[model samples]
Target: MTISPLETLQRVFGYESFRGDQQAIIEHVVQGGDALVLMPTGGGKSLCYQIPALVRPGTGIVISPLIALMQDQVDALLELGVRAAYLNSSQDWRTSRDVEQAFLAGELDLLYVAPERLLTDRCLDLLSQGRVSLFAIDEAHCVSQWGHDFRPEYLGLSLLHERWPHVPRLALTATATSATRREIADRLELNGAPHFVASFDRPNIRYRIIEKNEVRRQLLSFIKAEHEGDCGIVYCLSRARVEETAEFLCENGIPALPYHAGLGAAVRSANQARFLREEGVVMVATIAFGMGVNKPDVRFVAHIDLPKSVEGYYQETGRAGRDGQPATAWLAYGLQDVVQQRRMINESPGDDAFRRRLGAQLDAMLGLCETVNCRRQRLLAYFDQEIAPCGNCDTCLEPPQAWDGTVAAQKILSAVYRLWRERGQRFGAGHLIDILRGKPTDRVKQYEHENLTVYGIGADLSEQAWRGVLRQLLAQSLLAVDHEGYGTLALTDSSRDVLKGERTLMFRREPEKKARSTRSASARGKDAGIVLPPDAQQRFENLRVWRSEVARGHGVPAYVIFHDATLREIAMNPPASMDDLGGISGVGVRKLEAYGEEILRCVRE
Candidate 1:
């Protein structure tokens, strides 16, 4: 008795219908056709291959870059009553042997292996011995040589097609530009495969970029005011910053754990487990922490430092609001961030072409931060997707005023030029800001900078405003940070236009600061997008408590047992029997048989 794809979707994964191009992609793969799919996070990319694996005659082999997340992925599948297993280095000899035996005996439906392990001859031999329904290469962007998360192991994945010409192959990723997409197709030998590119927009996420002013205090205020008692991720550029931010948050009464490659494996694993298993645990980490995180309820993703490119920024921020709830993507950016990124690029070991590529990526990121237009519009355009201005971003919520800053640009460029031409010396932004505002400090007097004609010509603006002008000039390529690691400012070739009044400059006006609100914490749930009637809210909370207990007993994340969305639906409807519980969107036959009565009893109580 063969099952149809729609029947497999409803009976196995418990979804009523397919989204966007999911059904097409699945049908193509089920019929032994290759595909390259580009979808956003939480867009059900997994089901595209998983459903075909079930309906086909053999186990699906998923080549993932996320070795750390394989257990959780298999656990989630097991909960849905799917026969899933994984082969990775984390398992002991006996466990690996058992999984291998299961695969050879035709006992598993889907199997996940890291790209590194999958490339091994032994693993290939094992796979050849079993029937393979399809090959899914997750995170296909890693095949690009210039990507931030490049994995050299992925370059060998092209052999899968050669080795098994009959088995269909599917390549999937949540982030990739057109060039990267082409690179993946070329490298993986999928040139003739059909391409499916979904919309990259995540509308549930509200994007906000604030000036870095007492950033720690600002982050504290953001969490306290909007996302208290919520699971979130804070990204820093360096390990030292990760540790410091984690400690600061803890001292400020936020339960945070630091995660970086510097930590021991056990500590990293433990912190990651706590973050996934425990409720409201904030993981303060570097970029090392979030590649394959499956947690669905993270309410926010804040970055204290700027990301290297728009793709990386979009990927990190997309981790938020995965469950289709209101979430925040906040960034604290400032002049130092620009200086630091420039310094890193200048000092990188890459050659001229590589460095220029890095510089271009950084420039695009800076444009996003400085743009007065819709953030979402600019972000999606980078991926070659077009859309109107999203009303959810900070720019659309309160349109930033653009002021003609030609005079200010001239003042800053003139300062940099005089310091270089007249004094045969250079200065950083701090001294330059002081010189502009007519602050005759000891450093300014020592350098005789006060005697310069440009020193007191800009006393009309405040220090913050002057810094903003300098930052914008740097962003626009009118100014450059020196490579001497002293953070000194220098003029670029383009500065001549601004100095000669040939170029007009418009800068984003900094919004006026309002006093921080001291509102009570009664609105925390509402802030997390959990809105229900009083009785229903109570029931939802009760079900959550029960789910937590069940998850602990099973040694899996709470979301693996049941997502908040599913539980919320159950609470609102209050299922009367096993049949009613089985009718819910996320309940499959195996889950119904295993826990349907338990869910009904939990709801009634």
Candidate 2:
């Protein structure tokens, strides 16, 4: 008996359709072909593996990196009434023993184990005992040296295939460059695997790279103006920053929470649960959160500092607007951010080659920050995916008008130089913004009537726009900020060429956007229409449990077993099984022999 991929999709997963070539990819994997999948978060990458696991004859072994991710996958499977289990540090001795027993007994359809755990002698012995159908490497890019979050343990996972040659394998990640993709293939011994590269263009995400000025003001402004009452994630570079940002947001009437490695287990879990279950809670976290979170309605992701690399930025920002609704990817960068990030890279004790690679990665991230092109197109093109203009980002939806920034750039640079010479020090952005506004208070008066030509030249432009220009200039190394003397400003090496008119500065004016709407992203056709309304979904899930039990008795994957959509259709149609099952999309020729009796038992029961 044979079944089409579409049947599995509708029946087991409960979806009536496949998302962008997912059916084709699943068919390939179901046919026991190798695959390398590159899909963004909320893009249904998991379905590619979960659907295949149901079709194959034996348990699917998923090699994942983070324990949090393992738990999330298992939890999601459990919710769908699939027989899934995970092994990680969080498990106790008896629980671990039970999982091993389940594996040997062929009672589990999907087993997720950490990469390092899979390398152990006892675990390897058990894996050797199982009738393994497929070995999936989630976060596959981590095996590549060029990847931002490389894990040496993941590189060791290639030994699985050397030991189990016939089992098909699939590798998956959210972000990968050309170099990282090749490294992943070579390291994973997937040189011959058929790779499926999905479009990396996140059209629903609005990319806004702003300069860090008054953080609290800017954040509040952006949030109030663009993302009112929407679920959001704010990333800070450190735990302290996370707490501070969260507190500030909370004080300003936004329901926000702080998450970091330093938090106790219970508190962390509670906060995470709240963010996942509760809407409009802006989670201010370090990169510690969101390993494999399935939350699909995150509306915005803001960075208080520049991410270490483009991969990190891409993955972090990808969290937003997962429901395919319009979301914002906002990053506030300044010269200090670049300096701090560079110092972090320089401080690492990696090999010279690794350091060089890290440096290049940082440059790529900076390129994204500095780019004047359509952010979506540039990001997609980086990952070898072709896409046109997004028509939804801040720039695309409301294009920023430009003016001759040459004189403005020169005046800003000149102010920095004159301030450095007179004050013999640096000051914060506030002090500088004040200086540009020709404020002759004690600070300016003490600096001697701001005795400089460019002092009052910037008065024509608003304070907000000037800060943006200066921040960007400093990040690009054209201007320097002196942190020693309270962060006074200074001109970098590039300032000379700008003043000589040998260089011209081109920049966009502020982007204009309409008000946020109440409509969902699916309504706009950006997201897959896979949502289940409140009450109908509850009844649909009850029907799924009955089908899952029947599949377990028949010793087939619940989906080979039954699809969620099939059960939904069944619940809505109340099919009486057997001949009635034939009318369902998922019950095909092969399933008739394998699961016909089970479906009869399910619907009749």
Candidate 3:
């Protein structure tokens, strides 16, 4: 009965080996040590604590945030023949009482409960009666008030260490910057725990940032050309925008469902169920979604608006390519977005110091957007990670050309000054760019900007080129947005340098207006390409269909039946018997006994 972590991994969960630092973390925890694990979304963070919980003496207590997450994880553990259960509001009192009894009777190996529930006196008393194995805090990022997914209930989780001093604790998060990481440790009283920080590189996901032209059109073109029949998540900044974007995608032949807090609870649950059970169903959502989603085949994560910070962006995009397949993290931003974000930061209810911190976070994100270096390199640099050129992002694939934009920037800034300070009028980037590029538009004529001294003085650059210059100016702090004037451009102190010819400006050339038929991001990865020949690919698809049907019957996600990677291996090798199927990576003794014969039958067919 004395089983090692490696033995349990192969015999129970069906993995041949540990990934990255899982082995080390698991071994440390099994020996009564504490840890703070920072791993990427798909980096096997679960196994680190899961194995230790199984090998340790008593039931593992997991403090989770969401009911769906707790259910999905317990379902997966049950499929592996582990004694797992979850207690949350989703279950009635009878079911909750039964789970509690099972735990007290030593019938459960792992038990998950929400932080709010775990903080209750009754729940705390129940834990004191049992021989607890360890405490695993999932989504530890929520502990930080400055983080994107802050939950007030998580602040009380520090009691786990205080109440159960003898029990070792592990806190895990998919995304956390240095500041958030430090805050999690300080708040959770895990400052002295072993910190395991994995490389933040998601090599399978391609990063692309495009200047916003038209949001819907660009999103449609990208999806139609690159991910026609793929499952993905499209994130918007507002709930209203989420509904509109979901409807738009549905009207254009893409199956999309809207998910936001505005929707009824029943409707939101139904929509999420469809997204998980079906394939290629796009979920258009705001930041309210995608915390505990376990879908492994999300081919893309598109953002129609800028996120609050680089950590939020990284976490949102990290949802893609969870299965290590080729995926894309695409974003579309423009000048108006810059103004809107600044306004939000200024208008936040936080104090002056908090607002300053939020502003710094935005500045970091804007820096990533405007950097001339590799997108991945600049993004990782925000987390204090230095990396070489990724050669996969849009910047690395075709580096943007830079030019001496001093004269152009001055022309644009002078136009703003004349329109606001001299003429007693304010205009947005469109009108300012029009004046700079000498466009004969009705707005220009109606405002009589055509007769301004700065009008038509510099028409060397195209409209997009002018916009690019202005965007860079905003990013570089040479210009500010006058939100009271309906997002009119304003001159900053640094603008004086360029206006007085004291500074020379350099800006990256904008991308072409026409959409190019670029290769899919997955094409750059080894497994994203065709790993099997035509015949084997056919077999893999057939196995997938079979798995889907079985999962539906069992009311679980398809991956819980068998991951796509495991199915592909089975299809390629064509197991001749149950014995051969058991030899596969993900096929353990219990699963082989449950569905091995059926899988072999499908392979034969």
Question: Candidates 2 and 3: which is better by lDDT?
Answer: 3
Model 1 ranges with Cα > 4 A deviation: 516-527
- Model 1 scores worst on lDDT over the 10 consecutive residues at 518-527
- Tell me the whole-model lDDT of each prediction, alpha carbons only: 0.90, 0.74, 0.88
All predictions: root-mean-square deviation over Cα? 1.6, 6.4, 2.0
Q: Which scores greater on lDDT, model 1 or model 2?
A: 1
* Model 1 lDDT tens row, 129-226: 99999999998999988776788899999999899999999999999999999999999999999899999999889998988988989999988887
Candidates arranged by lDDT, highest first: 1, 3, 2
Ranking by TM-score: 1, 3, 2
Model 3, residue 427: distance off in Å is 3.0
lDDT of 1 at 548: 93
Predicted structure with the largest TM-score when compared to the true one: 1
Q: What is the lDDT of residue 236 in candidate 1?
A: 94
Candidates 2 and 3 compared by TM-score, better number: 3
Q: Write the per-residue lDDT of candidate 3 for residues 252-298, one digit (tens) a residue.
A: 99999999999998899889889988988999999888887888889
Residue 31 CA displacement from its true place in model 1, Å: 0.5
